[model samples]
Target: MIALLLALGSSLAYGCADFLGGLGARKAHVLRTVMVAAPASLAIELLLWPVLGASFDPGAIGWGAASGVASAVAFALLYKTLALGPMNVLSPVTALVSAALPVGVGLIQGERLGTAGLLGLPLALIAVVLVSAGHGAGSSRPSRTALLLAFGAGAAIALQLVFLHQAPADSGVAPLIVGRAVSTAVTLTAAGVLRRRLGREKPAYAMSAAAGVLDSVANLLFLIAVRSGDLTVVAVITALYPVGTVLLARSVLAERIHRGQLVGLGTAAVAVSLLALTST
Candidate 1:
């Protein structure tokens, strides 16, 4: 129960980070954002190290680094897609794909669901879709390229989650930190390349750095959650990070709440209830 709460908390924090990062990216360079945020994340991790009593095994470190690179790519692609496509179309599509992959993988790995949990699955899916729904009218049609990129970002996110789940439990938070470092480095490198090609990249870099820090913190919490709890439930709960994005849109972006989002939130509540009831 405690672990489950922690996992949910992690998801909420991550959602906030992603929301803020997205907003920040609009005003700054993704690479610069990542660069600035990476150090901030490192500092936070270092501060929490002794308290968490976390350490790293070589295997965990390697896997974590790989996960980081995947995550960095995922965020970069997601941001790019958002910049290019309508939020209404892109967000839900990417989110659905991302959430579905892990659920599918878990099922394949023989994670059985109870009746309530089975019911919860579809509701959770609806909740995610609703959460991803954006306010205001969007383009009548979205570009195929943007759609493809959104799906690709989803795949990258799935890979990151799976790899993180596979990291050694005993490695503590070191693997998480390593993963963040790798992600930060990769994003920064990509930013440099993009800047050279585009001839204007500072704002994007700054936004990416800020997003990276929040993402790092979220990743750390998620790692801790997975280490201490069932992966299936943890993944499901954490996947709901889009809820935070919706809330942010309402408060920060002054986007009106859609009926769909309210429904989604309600669905999530019921899904969570079902998960809790079924888990025991």
Candidate 2:
């Protein structure tokens, strides 16, 4: 129960972070938005390190750094997609693909879900596709570029989680700090190379900061959740973070909430329940 709650909290926070990050990236350079959002992650991780009794593990740190690169790429692509339109389309596709990859990894490692969970898996995939279709297949609303970016983002997101789990058990929050640090450095370097104007970047700073805080918190919650729960279950729940983004778009951007999206959300809920029930 605790782990489930933690994962759900992480999902909500991740949704908010991604949505805000997308908003910030709408007018600012993508890398610049990442640079601005990275600090909150660093600061929060540092402050919580000793309190959480995190130990520094070199192996974990290395994995974290690697994951950070994946994370940076994922964020940039996702925000770029969201900035264009159809938060529902990209959010579900990215999340579903991200979740499915990890589940496949688990299976290859000899982890097996029960019959119910196995059923839920394909259902989740279907939901993801439905959400992506949104209005219809022929609408051409999201554009090929946005879909391509979302696909890349989803693959990167999977890579981020896969590497993150490679961290040693004792590493605690230290790996998170390393990951955030790497992400910041890489993004900042990219921003500098692009010669993005600092003046223009300034306008998005506030949104970027808020997103940083939310993403940092989400990362922490997910780390904790994974430690206490099955990776398959935890990943599935956290992947649902995109649902929050879709809802936020409806509330904030006044975008029409599609029936397909609602159906997808419902299917996700059922899928999570099935997975969780069978796990216990």
Candidate 3:
């Protein structure tokens, strides 16, 4: 139950981070926005190390580095895929795949679930797709390349989460620190490579930094949650982050909540409730 709560907290943090990051990206190139965000994330992780304690064990360093690479891949592919247009099709697909892979991995690792959890898991996945639904389906489908990139981005995100989970328990926040460092380096490199194309628009440094801080918090919460709970449950609940993003959009941007999204929000509530009951 504590794990579920922590996972829910992580989901909310992730959602808020996405909302802020999206706002930052609107003001500058994605890579430029990430340039601010990534280093900010690393700074937060560094700050956390003293409070949380960390070990430099091989499992921690290796898995952390792997997750960092996966994260960099996810960031690049997701932005590229979204740039191709028809985000309505691609966003939900990415979210579903991101959530589904971890669930599948968890189950394959022999994690058992209660009957309620069994039912809730699939419902949670459905909610992920629904909540991530955009205002419209657009006039046409995403291109095959866009679809492939979305899948790749989702897979990379799943790998990041799975790798983080595979880190040694006693490693504490070491994996997060190492992962953030690597991702920060990757973001800086990408931004440097694309400097000519990034334009001269000033990035939303504050919002981007805020996003990074919240994202680091989300990752920390997820790591703690997964350490103490079933990965299947933790991953599914965390994937509900779109709920937070949608709500933030509606509140901050005065965006309308589509029927599909409304239904999805309700479905997510039910799924969380069922999972909660099972957790107890």
Candidate 4:
């Protein structure tokens, strides 16, 4: 029950972070937006280290660094795939693949689920796809390159979560600190390489920073939740983040929520309820 709550909190935070990040990206280059977000995330993690306590064990550094690399890859590929068009299809595909991989990993590692969990997991995966679905499919279908990038991005996302889970439990927030630092460096390097292409418009510093802070919080919660709960359950719950994003869009951006997403929201609630009941 505690883990379920933490995972749900993580999902909400992740959703909020993505919403803000999307807003920030609209005002400037994606790299530029990440430049701010990454540093902000690192700063928050550094602050968290003193409070949560940290140990830079080999497992912490190695797995954290691995997650950081996967994060960078996921960030780049995801944005590129979205830019290539047909976000409606590609976004859900990415989300589904990301959730599915971690679930598979957890099962292969000998995690067992009860009947309720078994039922809820598939519902949660389906909910992830439906909630991530958008209104338009864009004018053109996604190209082969876009499809490959989408798959790669999803795999990278899954790897990030798995690597984080692999970190030493005694390390506290040190893995997050290391991962954020590495991602920050990658963001800076990418920004440097593409400086000329970044354009002259003022970046949405506030929005980007807020996103970073929220993202750090989400990661912290996810790390804690995974440590205490089954990875299969926690991962599926976390992947429901798209529900938050879709709801936020409707309220803040006044974007219309489609029928599919509405059904997804309901399905996710039922899935979470079942999981919580079984956990109890």
| Residue pairs with backbone overlap in model 3 | none
lDDT of 1 by residue, 15-116 (tens): 988877777656656565666777667777767678776668778888888888888889789888888878788888888887788777877887788898
Count of clashes, each model: 22, 0, 0, 0
Q: Tens digits of per-residue lDDT for model 2 on 18-134?
A: 789888877766666777789877888888888886666788779889889999888778777777758656766777778888777767877777898788767766665664445
- TM-score order of candidates, best first? 3, 4, 1, 2
Off by over 4 Å in 3: none
RMSD of 1: 2.6
Query: Candidate 1 or 3, higher lDDT?
Result: 3
Over 4 Å off in model 4, which ranges? 136-140
TM-score of each: 0.89, 0.88, 0.98, 0.98
Clashes of 1: 22
Which window of ten consecutive residues has the lowest lDDT sum in model 2? 131-140
lDDT per residue as tens, model 3, 1-280: 9999999999999999999999999998878888888889989998888999999899999999999999999998998889996888899999899899998999999998999998898999999998898876876788899999999989999999999999999999999999988988888887788789999999899999999999999999999999999889999999999999999999999999999999999999999998987789
Badly placed stretches (over 4 Å) of model 1 are: 135-139, 196-213
Scanning candidate 4 in windows of ten residues, the lowest lDDT window is: 134-143
Per-residue CA lDDT of model 4 for 155-252, tens digit only, reads 99999999999999999999999998888888899889889999987779999999999999999999999999888999999999998899899999
Per-candidate RMSD, Å: 2.6, 2.7, 0.9, 1.1
lDDT scores for all predictions? 0.77, 0.78, 0.92, 0.92
